[model samples]
Target: MTEAHAGFAPTGACWICGGERLRPVTRAIFEFSAYAQQDPELARYTGATVEIVRCRGCGFAQPAALPSLPDYFERMYDQRWSDEWMEAEFRDGTKDLIFREVVARLSDRVPARRRTLLDLGAHVGRLIQLAAEAGWRAEGVELNPRTSAYAARATGLPVHRADLRDLEAQGRRYAAVTLIDVLEHIPRPVEALLGVKRVLEPGGWIAVKVPHGPHQLMKERIRGRVVPGYRPTVADNLVHVSHFTAGSLRMALERAGYVDVSITTAAPVLPPPGQGAARAGRVAVRRGMTAAARVLPFGVRTPLAMNLQAYARAFV
Candidate 1:
């Protein structure tokens, strides 16, 4: 295992299965300093050769080296969560739709006498608000001081500036835990899932949404061939430390003492793929494909969909 940068170091074993054997899938020298700009002096020392590696045993692929959680959120992931981004997110309805799907899946399995929901990485508490609308007493846990305060004020919910490990330490428990596009960002996913299990009440459920890794790899490969150093364009390589497949996600949950893990595809509401004279035609084609995907069985849709979710129940 090779270190990509001075700060970023490779995990000796697989993050999902703890397997020792890993093979390189693709290699890209990630320039963290160039996240927002391409600085000539800063780019030289900051460039890290990131190799996307896969477990020989479990087929899970992730970066060879990645920054720790604290370093990433504070320094690297500097895209301002501005008001414009919030308005766009609301307009897009992507987050709301994902929350609805998660809520629907967990509604039936919620533990008796447990009506509370804890949302990890709940930026601005939008999902917390939605969970409240679904009749759960929802509160959020965020790590960013600014977002946590803003969310608490904006939504009038208990948005604490803390991590899941901190919540676990305080002996808090919830009937449902939601992590929308969050698991992939963690440096040690197995440890994080273990913490999630500890914070969950018996028979509680965890609903998670993550980018489909295989799809992302394919997209990146296509783009990288035409444009050099194209990996940064896709946000996953920049922020997401771990890239998950369906098998790896289920295995991680089960290893953390969760049972009855179910992985499903989250339907796509993406914009049209082209422009110009045939713009309307492209939109119709995209809509038709999305409709067909929705009707298809899980086995068929799991690979084609852009995103996937895992629903796991804590039996311990």
Candidate 2:
């Protein structure tokens, strides 16, 4: 693994809209040493800092500086997990609400005959399994060899360890594709989306879920103020490289040639194990927020829309 201590450079253009009207939103010291504790690959850049900037034109936020190392993201995400932990993750139902919602929505949009689905970044193949159970001929594209192999073994499905371009080159097409919690990690979201468009069948639907960047930031700020000795981790180490508002996300899909776009509040990942009452209360509050956001006019602009879910079709 290559070290990137002083290898940060400015991303001069906005990732979503390609605009130069960017203003700094926040700056934080990214302690690579702390991350290195999990993945020793980052042991080189022990002390580093980066600025996150928001694009005035598109309401999208991104790290002002990108690592000079081209494979920085790959190295950063190359996590080594024990099989025990992976197994636990595979069995975790905390994300079942999200997976079920996506699968149900995709099923409703695509006809039964054209129910072939591809889950991009299918971590551990949980979504693939659920989609399969839902009667979709589901498969996945996962780059990590460990997770891809695990997913294939666990689900008895072909989890391709290839990039979207590679899959596109193979002439594979699907009725639907999903990018749950995936797009925000990519710096060039529109370019990646265009690649997704090539792998879809004509008029194929795409389901995307991403955190509402501005609202999430506000929540974190409030939490930090309320909780003593708390620190915000939303943009830590630029893990979430692209922060998107609902408008920006819809615009990104449209710019990538997707039509019939619809954006709404997405389901939340259930909180980790805790007291039954507290967990239920949190889930109830989150579900209520999502339900309310679905009905409210201009809901995407409200703070209740903490996460954005979008359904769009590739141009016919």
Candidate 3:
């Protein structure tokens, strides 16, 4: 299939595998933000077309092209985004559970006597805080100055306002690296992993959490056809450039030279903004999901959940 184009530029090749063999997945021309639908001034972006494509070579999915994102992101975290998201995440102990899972996975595979963790895209520094509490020396790399500053002030953890690429210049190595919900937002995920490889100690581990592909959006895709509220668009998630299935995520990790790579699925956590009656219903659903997640085997959840956690170790 011909590569899809967005506005003026061509998407070139798959960001994960550098393949030109692409398959068209879906197309939409809708506003990314729910609020944009109500405001005429902001609604101009509703007309912009976006095409989601899957790479036949690597099974990776991404948009046809990524537009200039810095401006959008700067405004997003500063204005629309909040540290409350992480606070809420911890309220139910999900983030803490994830931290323990990552630590245990690395402890089993990496024979390092001491563990030092670097959380890439560590917005608000909750992971670092959790790691430090668990006896791991932790620091963070964040791109947003505001969030980085907040993370340092709130958690007293050292969070550098820079990208993972900047760590190569510091010459510091870590025993573990984390990318929670971070990989998909990056335009060059493979290149970022290469940088991660450079900054890790031998036998060090990396843990990543990302949304499960195609399936997470299946309902939205079906709904957009019949309901205006569910129209598929990239506006709200303008920062996310890629989507990963279990196969694609594992492939990316192996391609970057990781060993003993393990991927597992977790219970689906519904996004926020629940109404009065619906909010109560969502809470009940979440409670049930939390219970099921505790007992469900990894084999059963891997194909059914909406999120996946991956752990990989670097080798000599």
Candidate 4:
């Protein structure tokens, strides 16, 4: 529901790969969403006029006019202590659902008694709260002061308002670092990953989930707005700069020094192609999808997949 503005003309090289051949893919908008923090006013944003661009080389997707730092944080931040947004968690709680399952899956590596975990993008601290229920002493770093304060008050846990990279410099460290759906937001994911490594113990584990590159691009490729009889392509809200596939994710993580990295794909609860949404409920949507994928052959899986990736790169 964003304002209608014309997309920018493409004349420059791609942002990441620097390929001279970059192209405009879509003219769309993403509204202020409370998936991260709790802010009713954020809904006021309605949406932003965005010119979506694609890199022919790496297939990275980003808005041509991404909000400046001030606009991205200060303006759109949800600082109103809005309970409406917090209670609306069940509506779009993909971030929490993925984090919980990831932790349970890696429970073998992380002891039940482990009580120290850090979330880099802990807006409103929902992931940290969930981790605490499982005995993890969770802390987080969120840039939005409003959400950070609310998170601290609500969860009684520390949600520092600072850049993730600065945590290590401030004499803070952690055992495990969870970056759920964060890599996609950062302008420089590699740098953020490096910073995450600095605060992690030697041989610590990092669990990351990124949108499957090909899967997301496939939605972009669909090339139609009003299909006679089909659900809209899950609203391509590609605010992310880097869309990481299994291969690209592995490469970037390896360069960031994560050693034992493995990638597994999760079919979204709403199975691709209007298969009537995987299982209909919040919990079942994703968990059920993963369970179904485990039993079925690869031939009958959703092309749009979520990556439940866990890797232990070098601790140095």
Candidate 5:
């Protein structure tokens, strides 16, 4: 094992509630080479095993132990893609449905005069571009150097490669902020939300989207039982350090001082173009699931709730 793997430390408290009563859920080995097939830089830690634990206080799940490396997340996400791949990602329309929903919701809530928006963890600035077209003065905050540069060049807009606290220090404020598929990867989610809140204008709205962690895990387990040679990969190598349910996600936002929080089912990414019957069938299933989830109460626990979409206002 690498020193980083050998030096793992227990997560002593719940990230959301600071609860010490945690129960072991499962363990999974990290086949780093398999996961790194596309990003060869992550192949250094090949044999690390991670344990997931659920907090009894809030029912939030997270890694029982965390890697000792200080720069673990940075190293894990340091992908080097070719310019051609980046261009393709920039033009992909799979997530356009999600981007449109978020923008529409924000436009309804935020006033026209205060239409500045910030997209946190902007991958290729696709959403920012769409928001710009929708008449919002949109910008982004990306930590990855390559993606930040590419997004800025492609969109002709500012993409700051700085931490949220740095923007807060600079008095940068926006009427709306978004963290799409970004919160799951962060640890101490409550603290992260608080930092995001600091950069928002008073009464500004924040939108977040994350996978329904427990439901996703259940699906993976069922698939493993029915499919041949299938391995569950939800919390492998602690890539997703925090796993959230509907209740836990709301609790995190509330504890971080957000008010008027609302959560619903988020739209799924569409399949690539021109796959014929298979793509059509997948789209039908996904749309049906999303529609089913919308009718049910947000507090109701259901498998149809594949992903959670949350909007809350910072009402300080």
Candidate 6:
């Protein structure tokens, strides 16, 4: 069962571990009025809210409240890519490479002939497709009606076009599950994982991936001196709601009844690592840096944490 609280707060104790050593790391203020004045849904927001709590014991940075469910997903959930870009970035080859590793590792965690794998918040079923090829019964969930239909049609797999909140009522369970870059968007990750746990067989694994803050770089156009500790003055649809250090992530999984957890730093192909990092006047230099990232050994590549890929098995 999930407990209702006034949102994770300063001096409010850690939500994952119940430790009280909380700290205020940074403050974020949102002003939706300019955008809200034009949009109907945006008007519901309380406007600007200050985020001021961090847990020193577990390194979990919890905001008071997150963007409402619809506002977070409906309007901001556009995964559009241009044609040429899609050709280069959306290759099944890239996806297969990533999923193959997970499937192989997960297979060792459990043994069965026809294993079932459910992908929460699956987009286009790319991962499911790869898992299917690796000899598992793969399926996915999508909120977008059109994309879910397309995924079902393309891959010949069942894709539930619904949210995780409603999944239990549908009578679902799986041998393995995945949530790639999906945890940050939800208003409540704990409840979300509880739902995930409900659907997985005991001893099965849930593999998770999310963007590590250290690796994302955005150029700031400014008029003065550049220094350390510079974050974007504002955040938008792409804003990260929950931020987790390795410790916070481990605690989250531990609380969810997952044992023998491990987090690995995996390199996610940056679609066009070259194009995004390229500068107007310094193409050659930037390309070199991008290539370096490709071969760079996985370690604390600072300013960007290696994209957080966590693997945990359900407790036996």
For each candidate, what TM-score against the reference? 0.81, 0.94, 0.77, 0.70, 0.93, 0.71
Q: Could you give candidate 2's per-residue lDDT for residues 122-240 as a string of tens digits? A: 98999999999999999999988888889999999989998877888998999999999999999889998998988899999999999999898899999999999988668876789
Sequence-dependent TM-score of model 1: 0.81
Candidate 6 residue runs with Cα over 4 Å from true position: 1-13, 29-38, 43-49, 67-97, 163-170, 213-238, 273-304
Best by lDDT: 2
Report the C-alpha lDDT of model 4 over 1-53, residue by residue, as the tens digit.
44333333432554444566556765555565653255444444445555666
State the lDDT of candidate 1 residue by residue for 72-134, as single tens digits.
545654445777665554445546657876876777777435778999988877788888888
TM-score, cand. 6: 0.71
Cα error, residue 15 of model 6, in Å, equals 3.0
TM-score-wise, the better of 3 and 4 is 3
Clashing pairs in model 2? Answer: none
Residue 216: error of model 1 in Å?
Answer: 1.6
Q: Which regions of candidate 1 deviate over 4 angstroms?
A: 1-8, 34-45, 67-73, 111-113, 223-238, 269-302
Per-residue lDDT, model 5, residue 36, is 54
Q: How displaced is residue 283 in candidate 4, in Å?
A: 6.7
Q: List the residue pairs that clash in candidate 6.
A: 23-54, 214-303, 214-304, 214-305, 215-304
Model 5 score (lDDT): 0.86
Please report, in order, the local distance difference test score of every candidate based on alpha carbons: 0.72, 0.88, 0.70, 0.62, 0.86, 0.62
Count of clashes, each model:
0, 0, 2, 7, 0, 5
**Lowest lDDT block of 10, candidate 4:** 266-275
Comparing 2 with 3 on lDDT, the higher-scoring candidate is 2
- TM-score of candidate 2 on Cα atoms, chains taken together: 0.94
Candidate ordering by TM-score (highest first): 2, 5, 1, 3, 6, 4
Worst 10 residues of 2 by lDDT: 38-47
Candidate 2: C-alpha lDDT: 0.88
Predicted structure with the largest TM-score when compared to the true one: 2
Candidates sorted by lDDT, best first: 2, 5, 1, 3, 6, 4
